[model samples]
Target: MGSVFCEGLTHAAMYARFRPQVPASLVNYILSFLQEKCKGPMNNAIDVGCGSGQSTRVLSSHFKNVVGFDISEAQVAEANKLEKLANVSYKVNRAEKLPCETQSVQLVNAGQACHWFDLSKFFIEADRVLVPGGVIALYGYQFPMPIWENKTEKLTKLFTDLYLDSLHGYIKKESLDVYYSNYRNLRFRIPFEDYVQIRNETLYAEHQATVADFVGYISSWSSFQNFQTQHGQEAAYDILNTFETKFMNELGVNTSSADTELTLRTNYFLQLGRKPTTTTKRGNSPVEKQTNLTH
Candidate 1:
């Protein structure tokens, strides 16, 4: 099979495995942000790169009509199956070009999936579909929050080095910065504003997972899966085993029944931009609104 085909299969498998583990509270928080920012009932909303529709389900509560689009047909199918609301729908589509009518949507949102989109094209499409004063919200979260534990930190560093060394041309930090900059740049283009990062305070919930769960989450990463396929499963498993041993030793976990309590510290970006209005004559751009919250 072609490399592209193989990558697609790997991604599908990975998404299937991790779809259920996505925290419900996180989804509700994102929806709450949209509700508070957009103000009142959002008549129509679109979720780009919606995956298995966990986020899409949250969106359905706020909008009378909600449509979720993704590049993977398998994901779309899964999302459709999981959607319980009559107003929610799922389709297989790319972020760069949506099938919706121009200037028709009230809110356009990209959840954790924003990192995978082409920012330039996504913004253009967003601008096209949003009505005047409509809102565009892009957000994502980083997991294993503090990552302060010595073993976790070292394993993370090792994973970073492996990816960098294997994918010689890839720059991980620069890639992350793209999403950050994309939201930051919105201030110049539209009525851009954002929230400060907040640390996870509550011991919200805890779950235990085996080595397979770790591998499943890692495989969900397109870059890591591609790297594994190119380098071979033996090479990938070798690294996985090494990291597992280190992680277990540090946590005093038993290999026979290895399980780790996933403690997550989440930082999120709540970027909101308003579609330009005709009456809003050109003037010095308005100052951005920012709020910092902690619990």
Candidate 2:
């Protein structure tokens, strides 16, 4: 947890290419909640741990300005390389200390990246930067389940087994734990009000895949880098290939036919909190003394 495993340029690029774009439906859902609590203009937003700006760019249409922040310079660089939007930018920064001025942001969000943060510090920073009654959203997806025409149940089990059994050890314990829990285990310590948690096992991000696309997506995993570092690329990909073979076989498709089509369906979860409109405290709020450390 001391450093981001996916900070390498190669991994960052792969991530930018393969990671699911934050769905518009999900973004609207978060914004809907924000609108109810904060009646002010949607001036600015911060996308925390925004790898390659997937979540950041999605917020551009919702806010006047949006910035994505990540600890990895490679990630920020990759994000910046994408088709630029005038109101969207990427910065290399930590989640615990956002760069915006206090009370200047209307929404703070992290998609599939909040588990890496020290939530306590992040919450305080989020609270500090958000306007009163602003919203904070943390959302992510579970490992994708393959739906092969009508064999969804079986294919899903196979992919789930591969993830939970073969790749689990390589993944960080905290990350895996949160994923299995659908992020229900995370604590929101910002003293937020009107908290809402959404768990939709039916939600899915559809992707058309080739063998290479499937392999590349798996390779983009942060845990895969750890596995590759320990076992070497050949040894690591061997496992992926073996699973790919099984998956392709399950669909009655030849492994040689790399373009065999199947849809990947993934579940989504969302956690939201709104800062209190009124705090009676005079000075030195809990958010102001986060860790007694500088970002």
Candidate 3:
């Protein structure tokens, strides 16, 4: 149930500090679909693999009670430490075995962390906990593209090379394979109704951060952490230092400070499915609604 990537306290803290929060538009997109088949008011929503409660906290605004689950104790502890709404709580638990009662949860969501789960077991658990018409939303963002005033294209290429080329060897292929395929490689079975696939390749979860902050975000990547573990801090930091220097140079910021501010444009994808209602027929074929929404 545990992921090797997110283990220690330092990593968990860094994850909480740097990972982007779930965008409100994406949340609304999920909820809109959930509300369509939902019987009554939105009640319980669970955020599985909820690292540091960033995604979990957002659900508090819509649900009566929102619970976040993660396999890492350090992550749950860091989530608990954060100031969240009274209705939101974090627990150390695995995705395959949810703690909720049968037919109780309205929505079961997994953010960037879904790729690490045993999807077959987790789907069964999601089916067990969700109400007949409840929704299961699996969503994640791709590597962030750096956006400056006018040099957006060149900066994006630089960022892409940093992620896909420089850190390629460090990436855990098994989990990232699912992620890199945008979860399309995952096979779904019966009892789940229609499948809604949304790929917003340009939908930006706009985040304002300094060059140091961006480096912090990059360092939070599991691949980067792996690199740090194997190569040691000095060697690993050399990569970030090079990135910082190049990024600052592109922006013409000669202050030699890592505090140069920039915007991060992250693309998102969502795979949504619904549990069959009482009158709905259980079928092997899933109806798919695919959309490429640009924002």
Candidate 4:
């Protein structure tokens, strides 16, 4: 998890271009829960770890004001460049130290990016920033179930076994810890009363892509990028191409631009907690620490 944002323009650009939006159904699912439980105005939402503003932009349509925050200047810059919403803004801020007043936000969210935070610090900050009955949602999604047709699922299995699986060592161990428990079971300081467990859900996204898009999608992974940085780019992409070849050959195609429709059964793990209306010296209360890690 060192250099969580990862250096280089190419990495940031690839993330912005390839990371798919969290499926609308999932977004609506969260919004619906908040609307039902919130006791304050639905004025603003802070999208922490909102890399490339994909999740941030989604919130803008619902909340009157949406702000995206990330520690990377490059990520923040890229988000700003592609963003045009008048009420939406991007900031270079950490999840544990948001530049906001106490109880100023209606909702605080993390999209596939909370595993990186120091949980102790984050919970304190989340409590301090959210209004009474304000909701906090943390969620992450698994890799896509790459497919061209029914039988092609086997091709995806072969590809994962060969390429994606090889990058396991490059992935942050803390992320594995979170996944093993399912995102719902995170250790947090949110009091038991305010802890509202969201059911684990599997939402589907049927996306159209060329073979190159599929490759680019994998390239967006932090583990894949880390492998490229440590072991020359030529060596890393070579292995990727072999996996690509195996899939293309399965489909009886040889080009990277072949039209491929990928159906991703994204297993979304959502953990929701509400900020306590009665504060108990929130930030001063000591709690177990969380890893400053990321995907």
How much does each candidate deviate from the true structure in C-alpha RMSD?
7.4, 4.9, 6.4, 5.1
Model 1, residue pairs in steric clash: none
What lDDT does the true structure give each of the candidates? 0.59, 0.76, 0.76, 0.72
Per-residue error for 26 in candidate 1, Å, reads 6.3
Candidate 2 segments exceeding 4 Å error? 1-9, 186-190, 193-203, 254-257, 279-295
- Candidate topping TM-score: 2
Give me the overall lDDT of model 2.
0.76
Model 4 misplacement above 4 A:
1-9, 188-194, 254-258, 277-295
Worst 10 residues of 1 by lDDT: 286-295
What digit string (tens of lDDT, one per residue) describes model 3 on residues 162-265? 87889888889755675468666635222254444544443458888766767777789888889989998767778887876787778887654444778887
Model 1, 213-256: lDDT tens digits are: 55456556656666677788666556556655555555565543
Backbone clash pairs for candidate 3 read: none
* Candidate 2, run of 10 with poorest lDDT: 1-10
- Residue 40, model 2: lDDT of 77
Relative to the true structure, candidate 2 reaches a TM of: 0.87
TM-score of each: 0.69, 0.87, 0.86, 0.86
Q: What is the number of residue pairs that collide in model 3?
A: 0
Top of the candidates by lDDT: 3
Which scores higher on lDDT, 2 or 4? 2
